[model samples]
Target: MFKKKYLALVLLPLLLLLLAISFLGQAGATTSSKSSAPLAAGVQDIVDRGVLRVGVKQDLPNFGYRDPENMQYTGMEIEIAKKVAAELGVKIEFTPVTAQTRGALLDNGQLDMVIATFTITDERKELYNFTTPYYTDAVGFLVRKDSKIASNWEALDGMTIGVTQGSIQWGLLEEIAAEKGIHFNFRELGSNSEVVVALAARRVDAFSIDQSILSAFLGKSNQLLDIQYKPSEYGIVTKKSNTELANYLDQLVQNWNKDGSLQTIYNKFGLTPVTEISD
Candidate 1:
């Protein structure tokens, strides 16, 4: 009986030793798999399937627009999407998406990613992850060169202001005015271009948009005599569950900022570079 008990004790230790080795091996395998996982699963899936599905706007000028000459989508946002595809080693397939469908498309997996000029907001951050800022601009009050309305936020009170409907610019303008205890007569325009035309035709006293966009428009038309920008910035949008992809994009944006890629894009379209709005 004693001999049997001793043998059993020895064999029990051996069994435990083997079990420990097996656990260690399984842990190592798991670690290896994790380390070897693709950087962006969505991107990898698209690459493996031999296509990169991107959602882009067909009307936003300088961001995403179809070229009338060739009917090919092209712009700063398109260029950024191309860069991401090049990094992932995939062919890009763009699908026309408006602001309304952008979230749903990404949610349903119809689009791998969206490179549209999507503004990051706390409200949007609930459903989507936002990368580091790709471009920076602010809400600017655009008035005719000869208009006498106040250009600055504090200076304008009880004056009718115009902004594009469903835009951050419109929201920010209202928020800032409320915070400052100023009342603004606000008009929601159908589109950004319409806001500009309204300002030019004296339909509205002012128009609000990002500084870079406002600058580009004024630079092209030479119509802006007085422009005042209230500090803000832009960011890339992605689904919140896509944390890995979001981090990758944020890193890429930081690298791009460091390497002057952002500035280069701005310069290509004849706009001034912006740095360090929110940091």
Candidate 2:
């Protein structure tokens, strides 16, 4: 009887200890499950991948240009991209893009975002998500100094103008032509450098694009027309379904604007952003 009582006492404590350990193990598993809940799809995917793929212009100087000799990218947009990667704690991979290819790449899931001087428009907003404008600029024309083209929109009537393919400048100019009752012949080229070459070869009378972009091509042989028009706002672009990513980007832009970070970037590149233009 004493032996039976002693065994019962020992077995009772052992059973209690095992029950406590089982309860604690289940509790720990529950806590971990709650803490490991997945993030939103857009944010989670990027975090899981460990890299941020970005599309950037390879031609535009002081914005997203790549050096031919060293193959290094240095520009205001590049710096902004680096900031984004840093914020996400990921490495950045830049894919060369142009006005024509940026949207297509985003649509095909080849790029996580595009910072290639993408102009935001109502039509574009229907297709992809856009952050608030980080930079604003106006359209301008670059003409040969010796071409004797008057520095006004009216003077370009019936003359051939070179514009980048898929740029908004064509539609903007169309509207201006309709308003002024004048017409312009437009040559849509694949890239900015091609348009510049067309202008140099006199294949087109003028090369037109954002004033800041035109400034890069300006030289002793060419001059920017004295006229600027239709202020364009550039925004960071992401896939339409990535609303979470877009919101995050929008908040970053808003914070940067408020804190003068955007202006600091502009100053670093010697850029003076134009919000409005006087005719």
Candidate 3:
């Protein structure tokens, strides 16, 4: 009877130990899977797919645009996308997107990366990861060449301004004017092209967009009032879940800046890269 009791005590502790070990093993597995998920799933998918699908703009000139002559995509942003794909040893498939769809497409995995003048904002960072800024552009106006308004932000008071819908420029004028007591009427269009058209058709007094894009309309409209109201840095973006790829791409961008590859691309596109990796 004593032997039976001693055996029961020893085996009870051993069984409890076994059960604890089992629980701990399962917990460790769950942690490992959760922690390494992005690397294992998101990064692997890029490699298995053998192609990087990037969302870029089709209308913004000097950045991403379709060459009207040959209908081929070409610009500073396109070149940057190409360089990333080349480094990844993968083919690039460009998907044209507007300001409204760029974030959604990237988040949904319909597009692997986005380089369509994507600005990094804290709000957007919650949805995706962005590389170090490639350029720091500013918002500028495309106004009628003969307009009497001064070429500065102070001139925007009581003006009818046009902006692209879902663009970063939304609320920017009002936000900046918060301290200046400036107020203006807004005409929100669906796209940058539409905003330019609105400016030309006299539907809006001035069109607001990035200075890089405004440069393309210099022949038809006067560039005025470079505004830094909102962040204007352009960045390469990937899914928030795609941390590994974002890290890898950031390294590539840093190396490109160090080696002057970025300078060459900017010079080719007639753009002055205002920001750098160091900044």
Best by TM-score: 2
As for candidate 1, its clashing pairs are none
State candidate 3's TM-score. Answer: 0.79
Model 1 compared with the native: what TM-score? Answer: 0.73
lDDT of 1 at 142: 66
Note the clash tally of each candidate: 0, 0, 0
Q: Estimated TM-score per prediction?
A: 0.73, 0.85, 0.79
List per-candidate RMSD values in Å: 9.2, 5.1, 11.7
What lDDT tens digits, residue by residue, belong to model 3 across residues 1-279? 999999999999999999999999999999999996443466567767899899998887778898779888988999999998876678899999988998889777799889998877888888889998887877667788778777556787888989887876757677766878888899898887787788888889988777777777787456555444544888899988888888888888888889999889989988885542210
Q: What is the Cα root-mean-square deviation between model 3 and the actual structure?
A: 11.7
lDDT of 1 by residue, 225-255 (tens): 2444455556777776877777877888899
Candidate 2's C-alpha runs over 4 A off are 1-39
- Scored by lDDT, model 1 comes in at 0.73
lDDT value for candidate 2?
0.90
Candidate 2 residues 185-216, lDDT tens each? 99999988899999999999998888878989
Which 10-residue window in model 2 sums to the lowest lDDT? 36-45
Instruction: Name the lDDT of candidate 3.
Output: 0.81
